[model samples]
Target: MKDKYDVVVVGAGPAGSITAMYAARGGCSVLLMEKDRDIGMPVRCGEAVGKDGLNGVIEIRPEWIAATINRFRLVAPDGAVVEPDIGGTGYVLERRVFDYDLAMAAVEAGADVVTKAYVNGLWKESVNGQERIVGVTYTWKGIPRKVRGAVIVGADGVESRVGKWAGIDTTTDFRDMECCAQMTLAGVHMEENACEFHFGSRWAPQGYLWVFPKRHGMVNVGVGISGMAAKTRKPMYILEEFIKERFPRAGVLTTVAGGVPCVDTLREIVKNNVVLVGDAARQVNPVSGGGIAGAMQAGKIAGEVIAGAVASGDMAELEDYPRRWEKLRGARNRTYYRMKKAVFNLSDETLNSIASSVLKLPREKQTIWGVFRTALVKRPSLILEMARTFGLKERE
Candidate 1:
């Protein structure tokens, strides 16, 4: 690896790889580093992406997809259910292959990609009486190496240290955190073209449980509980118990555990010469804790901004990263955060009632947006909030 580059992005996930690819394509020397020996091994995500969201950033390749989803069910505690079409499309990705392909794309775009490289610290220097990160120090192949860059991008996941090291406050409140556990199971009987979500204190305790199809006869089932509730019962145990009762004979294929930040986007994402993206910047949806699409979108913007700065030798351009992201997604995410806070407080009976109401709607009208409005029945003012955010008439 070179001793110096224009951009150094940590964490070879979708966000980091896309950032590296775009920056390199923009004519910046970029380095992408991954601590894992394989780019996407031991995947930590739910592996689902919205059709429009995915297409907005990258072209969808048939090889990267495991299952196609056109509809989803939302089940309440009382078994009241509502089926909603995702506008006839979505995909559950084979994240391992997808991430590896993204890294290779970055390499093809002129960035150097390295695996098994763990970033241990940042390279900082005193500038105008302040410590500013100029690069990073990482260990590759059990050997330490230092690389300097004009800009640094931290796409590390929720447990990132790079942002903190760069003096950005990356702390999240326990209430806003969802402790998650997932298992890929075979021998499960579920719709191969649909996904399922269960909501109630019993099922997930303030968060939600999801069952997404991986392929025929295979499903990814998981639960995300509020951090506070998770202290009382492990998320894995909760999911396992649910599975035993729901699909007793299912065979486990793989298990994953992690945390999802379900809060409003951070007020700050850029610090001096460094910028945080993906989970590091809390870009995940505050309601669903979905970050794949958000990460890729943020990475795209960050790359363009940083590359422009590098080319012009004006690092101040980095500030555009957060502004652009807020315009693109963070603003809507804040509305979702408000909706989450309001909905998560409803009684189980209330959620069942909402589900029942949604079920009564015309199939075409029983959309996610309809579900959101149903959830806001008690907090009707939030309906106005949503309308304002989306430029919809209050009646709509």
Candidate 2:
């Protein structure tokens, strides 16, 4: 194996694989590394992704998908349900197979992939009294090896060490983190074409529960709660209780528990020749905590920027990657973050009142945004205040 490469991507998740694919295809020598023995073992995500968000990035194969979705059901506090017809609801993916396939795409694009490689820390070189990233030192198969590259991308999941090693503030406050727990269950009766979401303080204060149907008469049933709420009640206990009561007849297939960053996108995701993408960049949506699409979008932009910088012999151009991601996701994140705060702070009575108002709306107008707007309509003063504070425009 070569001792060095033009680009080294840490982590083999969606972000890293996509970045490696684009970089290698653009004529840059790339090395993609994964700490785990497998690409997507021990699945962590809700495994749901929007179809529109993934278009043009990669083609979705039938084998990679468990089921296709066309509708969504939002269950509010007091068990009031709102069914909305929407396009591009997305698919429940078989993440283990899907992730491996993505890494294979990178390899096919001319990048080399190494698994069971753990990066201990970054390798730095001083040029003109300026500390610059030159490579990374990692242990692969119990043997220490060092690989150098012109650029390093951190696509390591939510708990990323590369970003911190590169001097980026990757700390996420408990108030801004969602404690998540999920289980794949069989023999569950659910709408295979419709994804279900249960919301409310009691159900998951500051977060929600999701039912994403998959193949073989199974679905991924999960709950994500704010860390603050988790302190009072363990997330696993909550999920277990919900399953016992709500899904009495279902049999568990697999269990997964982890945390998702709910903070708004970071202001700085780039420095020197290093760049952060995916969870390392805090690019997940604040409201939904959904990151698959956001990661792919950022990866594409990062690849373009990195390629340009490598070709120009000017590393400063890499800064544009973070700026571009901010431009694409910052506004929506800011809005959703503020909205999440306000929504979580609402009292049970207030939520029930909002639900009642939503029930009054015509069935055709009972969309998610419509219901949210209706709930906030009565509190015009608060709405204007939130808009001003969050720098959001008042949308009717």
- What digit string (tens of lDDT, one per residue) describes model 1 on residues 213-306? 8866888899998888888989999998999999899999899998999988889899888889999899998888888999999988999899
Can you give the TM-score per candidate against the true fold?
0.93, 0.95
Estimate the TM-score for candidate 2: 0.95
Could you tell me how far off, in angstroms, the CA of residue 40 lies in candidate 1 after the best superposition? 0.7
* Model 1 vs. true fold: TM: 0.93
lDDT of 2 by residue, 180-211 (tens): 99999999877788899987776777789898
Best by TM-score: 2
Question: How many residue pairs collide in each prediction?
Answer: 0, 0
To one decimal, what is the Cα RMSD in angstroms of model 2 from the true structure?
Answer: 2.6
List runs of model 1 lying over 4 Å from the truth.
127-130, 378-396
